[model samples]
Target: MRTVKDAWMMVQSEYRGNKLKLVWASLFSIFYMGYIAFFVGIMMNEIVQSNEGHMAVDIMLLSITPLMGFVLNRSAFKYWSEDSYTRMLVYFKSLPIPATVILCKRKIMSVIAFSINGTLCFGLIYAFSKNMRAEMDLGDYIAFTITWIGYGLIVTGLYITFELLFSGKIYLVLTLAVLIVAFGVAFLVQMGGGNLFLYTILCSQEWGLLSPLMWGTLLVGMASVQVFSKWTIHRLKSRDLL
Candidate 1:
């Protein structure tokens, strides 16, 4: 469709002169994930071999894998910041294309980035698990990878909404505050011996790949994307981007 073509063109325009940056980003993301995989492999080996309480640690690592996409491939956030700085949103708004198309380009880029990041993170983990003769199988790896990608997409949608709604120093401050709150909550949960929602979802494979929780996670992710996309478009159209 022409709309999809326009969105793709917009994405291309954003990366027009940033091929080198993209390459570096890709390499950095790979190296970062490689380091995590190595670290996780070491921890997994020790945990699997020991009879200590490793379930919490395993849950923490598995929960963190999906979030690594956001931490490493921050290109989407950077691009949004750049667009805001240059008033590119205003320029795009002046165009004949719908606001949905304008935002679609960013979402497409996000999906691509998160998919690659999620695959590398989980693929490397799976490779290490197999080498250690861990209990995981290809099916479990596939389910984890898909679920992580879905969770990444859902987080990206919320992140994009925040970027659109807030800009400049306010956004930076808010982001820092959010990180603090998240870390604080996580620490509390760990101290209290409470399980993370992600832990439940990730371990849902024990009931097989056809688990209702897995399906629900995917459904929630898909629905969240749709809701966030519509909300973003509405906000962009109503905002005075000038």
Candidate 2:
């Protein structure tokens, strides 16, 4: 219980330390998602441009939510890798909090940020778009939002694992290599030239049920957990930050 309390306090401290960045990050997320939704709303409305256009607007808006979520989550990956924060993480591990507990608190902070931005984005879309509650039921929208959050968590976890996998100057090389591989695989999947790759799985089916989005999210999350556990154990053993 005390450990949990300590973890919470640490989270509060970190949040206050980056309060300015948090404000900007929140603004950035809201504005970024708003921009995506606005363009998509325009595209849908222009194509239909009638009462019947409401369905088109709703469809496009809901469909793009996950993609917007993806963009915001990608930004967070880079943010965590920034030098000062990375050093902060090293310092954090030097503290007495349980490793898993600390990691969970960090992830919770991320989820809060993602949720704040996502909700704002959705609110902006609903307010400004023609389909404000027209095409989908509220229940469906809620489910989509939850799934979108799950997607963000999976992406964030994978990137953190990527950072932990390499060390020193080699990490820069590893970062570029990982980005290249990820994008290359994505492009190949987009071009229909890949088989059973992560991107291929993502592009394989619809967004619901046992779709690539959900399953791939689970797979990536599980993989990251395993890799992260190993990495954390090694880091604790070495007691080295860089």
Candidate 3:
């Protein structure tokens, strides 16, 4: 309990004075979702649902929440890597916590962020369901949301590992550009996996049995995150912090 509290404080500390950014971000989420619910939803309903291809666009949008989270998570390691000049590293290291614990907390934060986005994404889908004339019911909605989160966990591990490897003292713009390209390519790959997962989930609903493959995929995703967390800690122990 105490460790969780400490980690929460560490995460919150990053936002020390970034009030405006937080407010604006929250506002943007609200407005973007509201616009989708009212306007986009209505227009999207016009499309006749003939084939599974009708859901391609929605699945693509659903993938973005985690892809963005993966990039956003780099901020944590970016700060850690810049500790020599930033000196914020000293404060974090001085805590009784190990480097791995700090990273675990960051991963937790990423999951939480993705959870909120997934919830909103689910809401957006349901809002437009009638318009899109979606055939999915409430149970399918729950499964989809939970499955996306598992996928997000896998994505978070993969991207953060890459971030820790390539991150260094470089121009922020260049770094972002590199990440944008990388994320774009990765999103393409993830979309393929998500498409398969979604189709399976939709089909299995008729039989009222989610296949073991789905559960296995979720387990693989969870394991990837756990393994990578340990990998990050091992790497951290060997590196010197400024």
Candidate 4:
């Protein structure tokens, strides 16, 4: 059996050897970050400046980063799914290493990727938030920043769990549909004077409500990721190559 160090090498070597993949993966994330910077940060900043009553626009801009973070997380797990036709995963399965170990490594990788993506997303928003922050208290700014990062990490874990057990089509369909429906429901909440976006909640001084839901759902979603990891290992073991 290979040592943990050997398994680490196996994974890292694949990444190091594939420079093009490394570049493509990076560009993929850069694309999303750039989109948020221009469309969300710049355009939305202008919108808020001109149309101050549109809380929904600001809220929607805040939500996209975490949703993109979720997309980044899903990409981490996609290679392991049967749909990707990626050979490294197949190679890993044939080795003597434990599947649980492999799962752990992948989870670590996902967390690192999520953190980097979260930081970039945060930085972009913070840049745009400069003028807005001038009006808000320090404590609220801190809370808002933490809440944004917390939501990004939580949403990423949720999607990683989804990718583990479901087919690509199922993952894609359910994910898009659910996010669409969530915003739809959120719109109603906005219309009814009970905004569901965290940015709105915090700005409205309703962090009491948003805090529990954010932390509570995040705790539960993280737990689900652990369960999904073990379940995915069992699935890989039982699944036939043919």
Candidate 5:
């Protein structure tokens, strides 16, 4: 398709100058994530063993563990700095490409990146936890991978929207604020008792991979990417590039 060709061209263009650096960065990210996953696996193994009655909480923790790599690597390094991202946007804008195509490429890239990273990270966790008392089976590992990749897509959509709409400083401030609020709410929920959200997700897993809840979550994530892409296109058309 024309769109696929355009996206491939865009990817090549984006990586034209610094392909080696990007590759190295990606390798480092994988290494760091693997290292962290190993420790987290051990910790989760202990927690699951200790919390015999709270299987829902354990499942919830395991499900979201893949995201920890993203958070950790993001704190330490960036795959694309703001200046580099700005330059890429400017260059792409000057080209004879449609906004939809540009945005579609980004979404597709995000999905691929998260898919690879999430799989490797989760695989490490699963491998490391094999000797533990409360280890998950192969089926649970696969289910968690599918579920969290959906969650990662939703995050990627929001993060791309934020990058488009705000400057570096404001974006960083807002990101920190969002993280603080999320952690605060989650902590409060834990202090009050077990998380209702976790319980709901855990219950949803009863139907295995065919669960409507799981599929619904994936659909929501995909819909979010589409909505965000459209919104970004509109914003770009309506305003001057930063």
Candidate 6:
């Protein structure tokens, strides 16, 4: 109980420090997502009027916002892992805390933060589209928003682990290079012969497969948080902090 309480306090402190930053980030993302949605609505109108082009554009536009948001959150998490908060994490884990308790607090905080951002983004898009008569309904939008939050958490956790792995300057260059290549691969897959947009759209369908993917990602993220907490505690035990 004490450990859990401590973990909660730690989470609260972190959130309090970043509350303003979170609010601004949420606002920025909401506007950015709204802009993307507006652009998509225009393109959709053009395609409909011209009676040409595949439905892939629609898919790409819809999925791009979430994908971009997820990656941004991951990058942010990586950045934060290098900050003082992570050093504090080492200390926190060294205490009598059950690793899972700390892990849960972090995950819960992440979900709450990401969910707020996702909700704002969705709200902006919905408000902007009030006059456009878009085909999307409330239930579908809510489900997609949840999926976005889940995927963001998973990606953020993975990035946090990598940040720990490459804490030094030497590995930072390698990390950037790898991320560049990853983005290039994604671009090639989508613009090359692959129809990634179509797949994204299919996954967004009412009976789509995104739910399973989201749940699987959440489980994987939880496991990763546990592993990382253990490894971090072990690493800290080997080093002395004056």
Most TM-score-accurate candidate:
5
- Per-prediction TM-score, please? 0.75, 0.58, 0.65, 0.68, 0.79, 0.59
Superior by lDDT: candidate 1 or candidate 2: 1
Runs in model 2 lying further than 4 Å from the true structure: 1-3, 16-22, 40-82, 95-98, 126-128, 131-133, 163-236
Of the two candidates 4 and 5, the one with more favorable lDDT, higher being better, is: 5
| Minimal lDDT window, size 10, model 6 | 65-74
The regions of model 4 sitting more than 4 angstroms off are 1-11, 42-63, 66-82, 85-88, 136-142, 198-218, 234-242
Global Cα RMSD, each model? 4.0, 7.3, 5.8, 5.0, 4.2, 5.9
Better of 1 and 6 by lDDT: 1
Per-residue CA lDDT of candidate 2, range 1-242, in tens?
A: 77557767876875587777667666777777788667755554344334222233333432343333232443345543564335655766667456666655655555565667667765665455565345434544444445555554555554454444434345456546645554554455445633222222133223435455555665675566557655664665555557
Q: CA shift at 242, candidate 1, in angstroms?
A: 5.0
Give the 10-residue window scoring lowest on summed lDDT in candidate 5: 71-80
For each candidate, what is the lDDT?
Answer: 0.62, 0.51, 0.55, 0.57, 0.61, 0.52
lDDT, candidate 3, 105-164, per-residue tens: 767767666665556655776676583335556665565556656666676676555444
As a TM-score, model 5 comes out at 0.79
Candidate 4 residue-wise lDDT, 1-242, digit = tens: 35446657755875798888778777777777756665555544554455334455545643564455432433445644545422435556677557667666666665666566665665665567555445445455445545555555555555655554555666677677757755675676667765344343354245633456456655665666676676677777665543
Ranking, lDDT, top scorer first: 1, 5, 4, 3, 6, 2
- Clash count per candidate: 0, 0, 1, 0, 0, 0
Instruction: Write the residue-wise lDDT of candidate 5 on 1-242 in tens digits.
Output: 88878887776675688777568757876886688678767765665556433333344443343243242323224423544445556677787578778777776666656666777776887678754324445665466556666655665667677666665566667666655655665666677777533443353446557756556667887888888878988887865665
Better of 1 and 4 by lDDT: 1
lDDT of 6: 0.52
Q: How are the candidates ranked when ordered by TM-score, highest leading?
A: 5, 1, 4, 3, 6, 2
lDDT of 3 at 58: 46
Worst 10 residues of 3 by lDDT: 47-56
- The number of the candidate with the highest lDDT is 1
lDDT of 2 at 43: 55
Task: Pick the winner on lDDT between candidates 2 and 3.
Answer: 3
RMSD of 4: 5.0
